[model samples]
Target: MTVLGEPRTADERRTPDRRGAVDGGAWRARARRWWPAAWGAVLGAVLFAVAHRAMPDDALISLSFARNLAEHGQWALTTGIEVHTATSPLNIWLLAALHLLTGGHAFLAAGALLAITLAATALWLRDLGGDRVALLGTALLASSPLLGSAVGLETYLAVAVLVGLVRYAADGRWLPAGVLLGAAVLTRPDLLAAALVALLVLLPGAPRLWRALPVGLAVALPWHLFAWWRFGSAWPHTVPIKGNGRGWFDGSFYLWNSWPDFFLVSFTGVTVVALATAAGGLAGAAWSLWTRRWVPVALAAGAVVHFAALGLSHAPPMMYYAGPPIGALAVALVLAADTVRWGWIVPAGLVAAGVAVSVLHGPGWADGLAPVRQNWATNPEYEAIARDLPTDGVVYSSTEIGALAFYCQDRGCTVVDGVLADPGRVDQRWVAPWRAERPWTALNYRHYRPPAPIPARWRLEMGPAEPRPGDWPITRAPGVHQVARLVPEG
Candidate 1:
């Protein structure tokens, strides 16, 4: 053949053109299909932020502690104190790493944690119900406000354990799963009860139980030993020492108050959706058992048992405690859905509504108190105080110690009863005297003068107040020094 005569025919090139056009169209269609999921993730983050408007003081304390740890290798849980009573510093260690990676922006660290949770939830759903079903579950989780609040390194540690549970449950990998669960327990002991129930599910055959239980026990031993040494007993036991949430196993208070509160936290979505999903999940298990759907039956049952066992405890329920149930509800909703063409719209709509409501109504602890609102550590008052005061020496303040300690970058300043630093040590006797309606004087202290011995240098800072005749009125009294108002120098 001559040089130009050996060229290919038009048919071959023309056929490829048609095929390429078809491929392009297919890609466009796929992108259209996934657009909803893309939008859902974006809106989910927005909803999450709106729901968690007020940062929890406890979270802030943890953030501060983590910052101090990563920055300076500080080992103490309480600022400027050598008290090592609190057990297991793993959560703090993780958060400190997160802070260091994020260059110390707590918000960015929180967002990163959220993204990881979303990814983990997606992976779990994919394993359970294939790609489409998993996407639905991911959308629901990403949009949930309660889970959003839990999106931090502190919460990520718990989520990692959950991922491990799902992973091992799918494949029956005993040792690694046990180690992960043990780590979760160390991070938060409330998870221990749930992890135990999950372990029972994964290793149910009594013949193999003897072998597997030891494996898990081996993993959990070191944390327990460290905890026992630190807290004088095993486990941090936050429920007992940290709060006054103790109650009898009777019918009155536990039934009415505790149970109702627990259920309320669980039922964040539409009442109908919540109740129907729960019912369907139970019914599915029953049907699965009859039809030999042993896997789903086991999973559903394990989830329910874990939820009920932990939920029916004396510690009192919080939103974070409802994580497993929330996850169960997500699974149930997906199971109930018809994942056909345009079927995801049902769950997507419900998730959107729930997220909207949560953002609008979630509670803020710092909303009502005037002093707390105005004189926060982030405010100019604390900054001015920090600038003027001696840096090496500590300033004693009541009711805002945590904020002062964090914002002033001075570990020496002390505030009374900040939930983070003080925990159970902030006694009511001290708090009542510190925040008495009027200044403490001879009349008020005739019976009791506290803190039985006040520090000589630390004086009471007071504002203008109306005096009552009988109460301890210390207006213009000796040792009542005015904290001079100082503005920023610049």
Candidate 2:
């Protein structure tokens, strides 16, 4: 070794330099390889950030069920009653399990779910077409205004399931693919169509893929069968209770209305994704027809079939439902690109546009305290109402009962609603499905049981909230909630 002041030989100098160069090269290589996954991490972080911050009134409905299940070991939303209003069984179960795990913090459980599903989605996309596919797909999803607003719903879980379905189908892993398909249906029964279309178009060459059929039935049928036996109807009570949506199944509507979420609630992102879907779908279909490249075709068809299913069912054009297909189309566009290097440019540009708009808009993503714009009232307002409600007897709410019921659960107060908190009533009716008759609903008399006639002690009244965004005349200003002590009717 030379003294500190002495200059080292050229060999010694080159040795450290060479090692530095080699390490630098390796690190650079790793960065290059994982750059795409970096975007996925960004997506997950963004999702987790917003998920628990605020959610729509509908989301709290699910959480209420989870809370009831977790805390009381019962399926009823309130004591002395059982309701079947929560739409997704899997969402309820997942949320309930997480709810207990998190020591009864409801929103934290939702945030946890959002992160978990984002990771699952990223992994599945990476499996399908390396990290770039994950990057492109998650970016498309993250940029959407709809999915961000639907953080606490089954949308995130459903998306992760669908992405996994696509991956398994691409791999010819039909058994697992079928299981995912079943889970997809349980996430929202409407997703079954998308699941079938993805598998059929993606792998028509595999005859053994038929094995998926029986396995999927085994997984999904049990839940439906149990709901029928236990709840008196296989269909969600929500089927009839919620809005059936607009008559928008036409070609013209499909072209413009399928995906309408704007970036940062601006008009910029409104039709951007819709147009991309049309152009990308046509291109993907054409490519599949000409070159037998069915991957693009499968993606396009899955998106199309999902929207079609939603349209035919007159399902509300909820962004949560629209988001998964938007993601599928975005991925298809990238994969169907004429040149791998540039195919991502256009879709990536749209993503950039979304992020840019949000950045320009400012202050929105910085806080997670605002619920979705579609909410009936702010979280604090709901909490205040729950806090002020009477500690006992029945309380009725005509507006925004989900959060009210959830917050009021531990108050020794029984919240009942014609809309939710209680499973109101199913009239005497019968309908035939094809050639078979099915049990329409379970008639529960919880509200009328012995010591039964629980008179409404208070009525939580509120204005119609501007008659819903695009509906007819606006009768009253928004945010009108109050409690009135009710008198028993003779």
Candidate 3:
């Protein structure tokens, strides 16, 4: 018989069973701590897969650089050209590595990398605003048509880096925060403006700005120096190509024409969410300044500064440029919502409304779920032109060089980017002839012209011109030829 308050037999003690119970409880605790993040990751992956069903046209340009870097050991757009045209250095390197790893399937590799980044962004937001907001933000971001178009580009990765920077800054980890901001700049040079605003917000309260500033400069300076040495200018060649000869920060065309589209694209076609985000972002900035909450202040300031920079630069109405600002607004909104009772309701409503709008106005599920087939159907002309050319040919393509280079991957052919090549060859003579008749055309070729006196040994071919589909005033007037061609002098 067992004595009261004492052990009976050796079996009664059951040491192994007690240890097992404790081990099981520890396992359960660990799972509880990790499961939410795991779920967020899963949700992120699923949404990314749905959103990233088509690759953007610009991705092919980056892929060309990545392919050349991986296969031919060249950093230029074309082998042996030594031109520094790649806009996203970090993205180029990442895609290069993935190109090799995935056996030259750069698009697949880019999609996978984007999915992982999206998941990490979701997890970071989860830490900031609990499971509900995180899930909602992820869903909204993933469903965004702009974000969908940006899947194969550096935009989402930049957004993820911005989020990380803000998170680290908010926690007073200045060094890592600076590192991330620097990384963001590497991903997209234009993010420098946004980074400056964040640093300004961090500087007053966080006295350790010195600790971060040097690190950020160190990360970004080497690339700039290298670009200067290699390309004769630290700026991307596209600056001269697309800046339309205007000084940087000299204009506001984007503010007037592209601002509304920015909001529409960023908010996934939902006007209500866009308006709310703008209102909340501005109000939150003011509130944060009053309360001296530097983190939200930094986010709000970054959004404003980025938008202004884009406006000043007269940037094209591309949705990807809005990624970081939208992300900042979302984070600001979540943080602001947390201050009020039942704060989760706002994000939840935004998410639901965004989803409804997407369903009503965006692509249907059948199209959304469709597998990403090879882009050959839409780009058959480029492929045909590529195939018809000789293996060692050099083709000068006007606008669709991305598709041209991508399809010509195996032909040992090289593409001279019409917009970006031979800045020194630009002559006022070329523009004078067309200025009065075609002002826009004159401006496009004002800063660059094809290399003169093309050697007989080099073959030059032009892609067929696209027909203007409409009779709109802005459309190419009838009988005006789209002169996207390169022909050697007779």
On TM-score, the candidate that comes out on top is 2
Q: Which digits, one per residue and each the tens of the lDDT, describe model 2 over residues 314-422? A: 5554445576676667667655553345677776776776565445434443432332244445455566667767765678765567767777876666677665555
Q: State the lDDT of candidate 3 residue by residue for 1-490, as single tens digits.
A: 0111111345643443455557786666455345545654565566556554345556767877788888888875655554556778889888899889899887677766776777777766655555565666666666554455456678777777777776666555678877987797788877877777777776765566657777888888888777666555565655444344332233443532644544444333544555565566677667666765566677778888887777665565554556567767766766666556786587666667655654564443223221222122223345555565545445554345665677677766666544433233222222223344555544334443333522222334333355333211111112232322334423
Higher TM-score: candidate 1 or 3? 3
Global CA lDDT computed for model 2: 0.62
Alpha-carbon runs more than 4 Å astray in model 2 = 1-42, 242-289, 360-372, 425-455, 464-490
Cα displacement (Å) at residue 324, model 1: 3.7
What Cα-based lDDT does every candidate model obtain? Answer: 0.46, 0.62, 0.59
**Residue pair clashes in candidate 2:** none
Which scores better on TM-score, 2 or 3? 2
Order of candidates by TM-score, top first? 2, 3, 1
Off by over 4 Å in 1: 1-53, 75-77, 82-90, 153-160, 204-215, 237-239, 242-244, 247-313, 332-346, 359-412, 416-420, 423-490
